[model samples]
Target: MLDKTSPSLPRGMRYENQLAMIEGMSLADIAREYPTPFYCYSQSAIEQKMQACLKAFEPTGAKVHFAVKANSNINLLRLMAKAGLGADIVSGGELTRACTAGIAPADVIFSGVAKTDNELEYAMHKGVGQYNVESIEELHRINTIAQRLGVVIDAVLRVNPEVDAGTHQHITTAKKGSKFGIAYSQLDSALQTAATLSSINVRGLAMHIGSQITSLEPYSQSIQRMLHWLEQLQAKGFAIDRIDLGGGLGVDYGNGEYLEYSDYAELIQASFANYQVDIQLELGRSLIAEAGILVSSVVSTKQSSPNNFVLLDAGMNDLLRPSLYQAHHPLLAASLSTSARPETFDVVGPICESTDCFHKNYPMLRPNTGDLMFFTVVGAYCSVLSSSYNSRTLIPELLVNGENVRVIRKAWTIDEQLKLEE
Candidate 1:
């Protein structure tokens, strides 16, 4: 049995979602069948967001390269691929899965700080679309690998503009001192070295200052830096063809800041109108953030002096962003979502680790035992970041398209977790 409250959904989301109500079924029914502590994604929402992104960015002739680090569920990947979105891969495993999902090798872009030689060889052999070259040493390594394989590798220099995107310190990756991209000073020499290498074709420039960035200032700074560097590269007699603007769009995860897809696209579209270079946007969070929800049940509620904790079945194992970055996700009693007198309570999960907490000292209306909780804006990093700590079985995943639903990834059993150990 469960209590009834309005679902804590995003601004335009439906409680009895069109996807949820199709064929007279609901999210709760799926949860009942699959049990608690699972992930449910809306395929319709994904398609809707993708369409929005495309419509918003086309003016600039930009191509969307969906970042695989978001939610790489194979079915979801296939859906995105079929939607004509290019892929941005970071690992050999991701590259392999991108192919398995039917993404064309030429439509995949590989980017990571520490790509192994074997991984690079595998990607190059598979003919990945572009390699986001991170460091000068990486450029040398790729050239060596390409030379050995009797092939030519196309690559873009990932330059660090050292712009500070006021996001979590862990996510602001474009700083001068960060390990992500080449420093400004070292970029030109890097291009020279690549141009001199017969096995490597220098195609473009790329940079992403940081993640969960809500403001436009940091992006503008990064873009301005890129444009200046781009001019410098062009002036030096280098033929750079593409501009890879890395992904860093933020979402309204109770951060009190919500960005519109149309506006973001319009801004970029305007910027691109002035530049004729081939452009790419490796979008991840912005495309999928509003498309899914995490459904967890309140098994127990505790009230101590000056503190309250709602013990949820979902933990950091289910959604690690909260514990990982001290991030917040919108939460409320799924049954009592419309209650006006919501109380503030710490939301914690069942993982044995004390860091498994979801929200601490957050205000919520008085929610009780057996009440379902809906964690909003979990569409991006939730399932993909899940872990099997404490030997917990992987949770089942349900994909919903309209009122239609399919159990994409099934919940784990204790036996399944121990099968390998035994």
Candidate 2:
């Protein structure tokens, strides 16, 4: 089952003679020990990516807060916390995870458009750092909850700057028609109303244009917009202390290419050069996406009409980005013959639906039954979005540090999952 280095692999992911190693350990060995249809992450890769991000934003004095929704595994959170990164959470569960992972409550920022009253109450009780208030009603709700708890809650109004982040339409949050943040047109009235809230400390401003953004122009525009509003609010006697530029830096899913953190930091520092405010970044994907891979075993290969199909044991239940967002995650055979020729494959999952397909007419090394296939750049949304669709139990998550591999999240059995309601 050994293979040679093929041109199909990404830069970081390569075949060392006959073994596919991520960081230092053999991916095939990990897959065999943990079984197929599992997610594996590289500790060094995640740390390197995180450090790069922090270094980039150091000039602007921006605090790095890892978005919990991206990869909420407590172990990953613990790693992030140990690296001096905070948490940007959207739910009570995520908030609890952040706390349990040893992240300080003062380092947690609660963010969500439709946060429930219970969630607000819990956030206030936990004394989370900031609430990215999305709507006027939500603002009032947080204020009321904080007042009930007899504590002052710090918050930032998430304004919808209506700028197109030039990303996927579904992920575009700050667009004119998006339901994410408060309308920019009514920001003035919203701020006035917010300032009147007794238990709410309107500390600053926040804006997230969109996700998977490659260019820095949208961010520059969004920052300028927020700064202009900040100046306007300050002129009206409001003291803004922070500006949270929500994180959505995209990764190179197709290839090993991405805007360097240094370059991104330069852009951010240049944009905020004349201003001084506590800058906060909530980066999620860019820091973790490329650090992980999904390894699945090919169940069978069949010749379909006008195409060859390679079916995997891992389906949409394991990784949903392909079906959900038509995302492109690079795929390669874990073992490849030096003389094997490249062939176009319709790589698909075991799901019964047509959307379960991972790639269509994609060219890669030919795969055979029981052969391992490594899906790259899936460290972010893949595992978090997994489910028990078709009653397939959730898979395990392995963390690789040097030559060590630890199962961070154990795979669930169907019976164990059924025990939930029992």
Candidate 3:
């Protein structure tokens, strides 16, 4: 189905102000047909986001490698591949999923700190675009695998420039002491081994500072430092053909003003203009977050101590951001009424864990039990990270295209879950 007008998501669906289409169908209608807890996607929103990203980075000669870990649903992957995007993978599973999605093996680039020998061997057999080596040991591993496979492997040294991305500490990587990439002090030994290892061709550099990075200064600093390193490599007669910057572009959960695609691309392009090298970027959250939202029904509500609790049918088992990162997702009542007085409610889920709360200071207009709720900005990490904890059935995923909607992932059946039980 093709979307005509832009989508206007219900509040808490993401960046509150964007127009929400609900796929030209009502959220209540979708819930009634599919069941209480399910996932809904906006075809137009995803396409628009990709368009914006392409427009922003087109001037920089950059290729967008959709981070497969962000959302590995095969249907979503197929849509992205059709859009001419490449894949940025970190594991054998992601690489397999990308290939299953019809992404060319040569278009895939692997990035991670600890790739096992088997993962490297699998990637080499697939003739993946490059192996982003994080340490000298990894380089040796790649060479070892390539030698056994009788194929040359291309590699990019993932360097730690020590730039702070000002995001959450758990996700922060490129910091000097972080366990992500090689320290600057180890580069000489790495390059020395790389030059001698005929099985591995070290052709590029890669860096991923952190996740949810909304600032430009950190990126600019990282790019400048990387370029200087590349220049040094060129001075040493090592052929460096590209720079793969791992993507951590943050989506506007509340503040779209903080993340602007144009400004971010402009900062990177201006700095890299001196060099005529190919560039690739791997992005996940920023591309898919707004296009998807979770629909859940408020099962009941009660007064607890000094606060009102709105219990939802979905929980951290369905969406783990709250439990994992202490992340706050916006929540909105689908059947909103202007006349009803708004109230502050702690939006929670049925999971037994006390930490299974979506938002503690959640704002709500008057809402009743059985009212549908929308959890915005969940397109990236939500569904892919869901679990069967408490034996909860997996949420059904629906694809909405204009007035046409179809179920891509049917809700998990009890029998299906039991099939795996011993």
Q: Return the top candidate by TM-score.
A: 2
Give the per-residue lDDT digits (tens) of candidate 1, residues 177-215. Answer: 899999989988999899789999999899988778888
Error of 2 at 94 (Å): 0.3
The true-versus-predicted C-alpha distance at residue 215 of model 1, in Å, is 1.4
Question: Native-vs-model 1 lDDT?
Answer: 0.81
Residue 359 lDDT in candidate 2? 94
lDDT, residue 96, model 2: 96
What TM-scores do the predictions have? 0.93, 0.96, 0.94
Over the stretch 1-422, how does candidate 3's per-residue lDDT look in tens digits? 11223233422232213323385777766777888688888887888888888988999889998999999888999989988899999899999999999999999999887888888888888889888889998888888889989998788899998999998887899888889998978877889899999998988888998888888889999999998888988898888888988888877675442467788888878888889788889999888887888889889898888999999999898999888998767676666566877788888899999999888767677567788888877888899998878988988888888777789888886679999895
Per-model root-mean-square deviation over C-alphas? 3.5, 2.7, 3.2
Off by over 4 Å in 1: 1-8, 11-13, 16-24, 337-341
lDDT of each: 0.81, 0.85, 0.83
Please report how far candidate 3 places residue 37 from its true position, in Å.
Answer: 1.0
lDDT of candidate 2 over 1-422, digit per residue (tens)? 01125444543466777778876777778876888899998898888777777777887799999999999999999999999999999999999999999999999999998899999888888889899999888888888888888999889999998888888887889888688999988888878898799988888889888778888878878878888898888899888888899998877776544556677788778877877688898989888888888999999988978999999999988999988888998887777577778889899999889999999999877777888888988889889999988988799999988888999999998999889979
Give model 2's TM-score versus the native structure: 0.96
Which ranges in model 3 have alpha carbons more than 4 Å from their true place?
A: 1-21
